[model samples]
Target chain A: MYEQLDQSIQQLMWDVRKRTLKRMQSAYDVAMKTSYKDLVTTVDKENERFIDDHLRKLDPNAKIVSEEGLGDKVTDLKGPVFIVDPIDGTMNFVMQHRNFAIMIAFFVDGQPVYGYIMDVIEGTLYHGGPGKGVYCNDQRLHAPADNDLHDSLVVLNSGITLNGGHNFREIGLQARGVRMYGSAGIEMIAVITGRVGGYLSYLHPWDLAAGMAMAKELGLSVKAIDEKELDVLSSNLVLVATQQVSRDISELIN
Target chain B: MYEQLDQSIQQLMWDVRKRTLKRMQSAYDVAMKTSYKDLVTTVDKENERFIDDHLRKLDPNAKIVSEEGLGDKVTDLKGPVFIVDPIDGTMNFVMQHRNFAIMIAFFVDGQPVYGYIMDVIEGTLYHGGPGKGVYCNDQRLHAPADNDLHDSLVVLNSGITLNGGHNFREIGLQARGVRMYGSAGIEMIAVITGRVGGYLSYLHPWDLAAGMAMAKELGLSVKAIDEKELDVLSSNLVLVATQQVSRDISELIN
Candidate 1:
């Protein structure tokens, strides 16, 4: 039902990647929205404007949900909802100028239709949805092996293992090794591409929307921490993992 | 005195990157050396052999110290010494097939003459040493700005912050963020590129040698924790950072 739209959005993402990278090279200002951890940049806003405008041109009727407040309030996913995260790893963007991503996911009545995660620096776009099979650029990406925690590495952020009361430390020890790259979109790429077994972090709707869509298409699982129903309109303590690793995480936690 | 030698080694590193990445695409056997965390693959042995032979041809009198035990067992760095970490993130290699590196460093009479770190997946060769400027893929890489903990991100492993008592958690909270990518070579690349402020980990001679060489050239500090003098023959708890941030780490620890 969405093949033509998928090709259009993928082309749009390539255009977004090129223009955003050019802006990064030319000039951009960095500023903190809440704290040093939460950063926003002029490039981010400009990119959001660029993407939102293009998305509007593509699907003007879609209700948009964006990270930088350039789109709609998006109270409900009642219709075609467009979720945009212009630069997903804002701190990495502000600090390292790499490891960030441009993400946009299209949903219809809360069901993900076509999701896009463009690794801006590498120029590899991970895009697809239900019935579409995932693609890392032009190649057909394979689903990860159904390996459990013992044989696979996991992606983590320190807050879950250090600040919160979770068994992430134990999980890290059991799961071959632990890797922490501070980008939700990039880390999700890790999971979607089968590079890591799973990823656990507190992620916003915009941050996980595209990743969740791609992961699901690749036969992986995405869920909230407590196994509660995930609310697409709100922040979620998210876990995206291979099916076996998902059970392994629960087994260890329990 | 060694301009010609530098270009030659850099070219050799680029070749090593190509061969290693090609080997990764083919069949390889993964085995546990000490634990699941310490992995060695057939490709690691092959890459070491490839690099050792090239180094021998480049400088016949040099001694080699290799990770997979494919090189010499010399006691001290009395003459030209070539250190090789065939696959520096073997776990990442065995699992993810990326985030690994092929590292080789040349030292003359215990002084770093040249260093090479090739990020195999990305195909970026970061190489240089004393009297030579660092280059990231032919671009003159600039030394990172001297920034303190609060304004910068830090790299860490779980053992330090979660298992050992090093004030790393407090230090992480104070810093911009803490990143842990699991590969010593890749993490060191992050430090050399100024992507992150510092990296702290327990490192072996082969793991630290190439990074130590290039890092020193870029004006970053490489030190043993507790201000102990590092022994090139043994493993040490290493810290690589900007000078002021090195002081900041000491302050937080004390």
Candidate 2:
């Protein structure tokens, strides 16, 4: 039954990816008129609507949470719940057009059962179920080799790092290097693929839900500030890292 | 004659973009035996060779300066020389396969005469010749509005921000926000397109050559640290910003 549900959700995600891509090509230019900081294009709204409608049809009983306000309101994340970010990295979607992604995760009783992150331009999906290992397209991904902080490149938010938010600078100083690729979904893909040992950012639930699902499946540590289990309903400073690297980073930052 | 020269260089740049794209797709999955920090993939060398060979045919007498050592020895910036970075943001190219770009610039008597930055996957080229308006794929771009620090977004390397390089914290505090996009070439494009007010990063010459040309032509300020004119062949903390935002950030950082 879980396998059947996973297959259906994957199909839904692919459809979402296609519809989002078409809308983005036409709507990106319109964002130029809006204030750059507050730039949200017509595509963002349309994509979220498209995804939400399809998701409701697929799982009528599930509560939906999303960034673009297309999903239902729910006080608690119990039973089957779907978290969707129709377009993660709206700035990149409106401005750069390539770094943005479509992210969706299915959680059961506060635990992610499935996650999907699609790089729309490349048509590549990084996805997996809890017991089924991660896959980048058709190829299965092995768990990343254990890596240490001094030997690891990390992804961090420049704003947070500069503001000394969540002790970001101490973590930055201990790592081999730091990279910031804007989109939380894409950065999470990097972490799952082992391109970066960890990713640290203050992000919304829709921004993290899908990627967090994949990270946990790939044997990486996923935690909120103070090293607690992630609260999937609010903004949190999330850390996704290898066990050793997470330990080193947490020690520095904490 | 200048028109013909510009067309020739643009054609060469397109070819480089195509070849690099193909090479990158095929080579990204190879395992690294060396340290990740020092890992230079086969594609980098091959892409540099392809670019160097084509540029040499276009300007046989011109010295070629390149990042990957596959070009002519360019100890002195003399005569009409071509500066090329076959793949800027090589780590992104290797790890993410999306954020990187191909950069090229022509310096005549050490003054930029032409520049090209190609988004390899998107096939969009930002190019211009001296006195010829800057363009992204045939559409002319207007100079960004004169923005102040409090109303502007600045792009800086996350590493630099964390280490307090150039007082990035102070600069971040003054600006509307700070973003780290991980690619100097891409960050320059952000500034050119008005998505970002400025980009500050410690950059090598190849990284900044093409970007500086575009920024300067579009009425943006491109300066070295301490408000000095940038020497074309040296590494420095380069600042590319709109005129007013540059002054505001410089005051904050200094």
Candidate 3:
């Protein structure tokens, strides 16, 4: 564990979180990044800038990969790198003003060192790493029971499930129940907290980075849906689940 | 308006909310009511008893129709009635210990007087009716902009949507996005808060009553998917949404 780096990162997150709450109480300008579903708010940009400045100071040599284009192009994670999503669920941020999260992951020489997924509204910080163990605030979390696919709830991207992407509709049926919370960070919170058996979504690097680290640290299966290696800088259809559930999903889809 | 009833109910809800939070801090027994999808926990039972006893003292003359069988089995809403769901999302309550709610609705001569839908974890209480107007805690709510179905998100029952029940899949596809949160109370929270344009689910009386009351008061459409008048005492495919969204869903389904 990078003890000093971890502490610095956690402190930065809490500081950023306070500003985010105050910033959210007022209005912010919003613009579509790609589609109406893809939004970028002034708050998102401000938060990214705030975090980027702090991250730069925390690890001067580390390259920062960020969603809002304020950081490096980050073609690879060959060295110390920080991947950040200032607001992981912008649509939910625009519509509900809740369920959005700030996610950050740190990697050293291509190995995850630590990750943070903060539920902004609830002020809950889920942070830790493989050797350090995962935590919800000060509470250490055990690896959730690996329940069978048919016996546990799953979180699916609603669009994919409705459109039958990767036979997600069938996968939804196989689970004990299905939920769609819109925010990947919130969905990942469900997964890491053992609220759901797993999550399946097509996500960008910034969206998947923090969640993937936490899932991996928790000893959950974190993999590409297509059974290929996940390029740390590229988007993919990802599955973060228990071993048994992951196998069930892969078999059903393939 | 039963002004006295309204004040008493709100106070009772706050009291119950405190007790519920305290009760949840300890472990509770969980049992399946019918299937794995259906769960009843000791918290549900204890919460129901607490609320029932309070309701009995608050409105000695009114009938209580509740989910846990702590209520009357009257066939119709013929007089002053209090419809309650001690815990609206028992499955969510069991699995996540959050995203559940305590819901209650009051009707006199089959006309809604007021309703309460409290998001248990968030401690947000949405309570109001037609003449009194709706309030989320101390802030009064205006009718949310009735955006077109294609522009607004729709919340669906994951099971029903995947199974194409009531042509919900098609309806889901037509919306900008779809989300499923599992609990009727939580889903209703999305609707009444104007976070989503609409919500559709197969619901029991207790599940639908409080949400329906709040939605109606907010000037949204609260109706049966079949375009039939709701019975207020029977299970049905319920649609609670902005007027435009409701019409769009009905058109898409038909």
Top TM-score model: 1
Candidate 3 TM-score to native: 0.95
Summarize candidate 3's per-residue lDDT along A1-254 as a digit string, tens digits. Answer: 48998998899889888998889889899998877767899989999999999999988999999999999877778889999998888888888888899999998887888889999988899998777889999999989888879878899988778877788888988888899888989999899999999899988888887877788878899988889998777888899999889889989874
Each prediction's whole-model lDDT (CA): 0.86, 0.80, 0.87
Ranking by lDDT: 3, 1, 2
TM-score (all chains, Cα) for each model: 0.97, 0.84, 0.95
Colliding residue pairs in candidate 2: none
Residues A1-254, model 1: lDDT tens digits: 77777888899899989998888877778898988778898888998999899889888899899999999988899989899999998888888888999999999999988889999988899998888888988898988998898888888777767663577778888888888888888999999999999998889988899988888888898998789998878998888999999998977762
Instruction: Give the DockQ ranking, best first.
Output: 3, 1, 2
lDDT of 3 by residue, B74-107 (tens): 7878879999888888878877878889999998
How many clashing pairs in candidate 2?
0
C-alpha RMSD of candidate 3: 1.8
RMSD of 1: 1.6
State which candidate has the highest lDDT. 3
* Per-candidate clashes, comma-separated: 0, 0, 0
Question: Which sections of candidate 3 miss by over 4 Å?
Answer: none
* Candidate 2 displacement at residue A108 in angstroms: 1.5
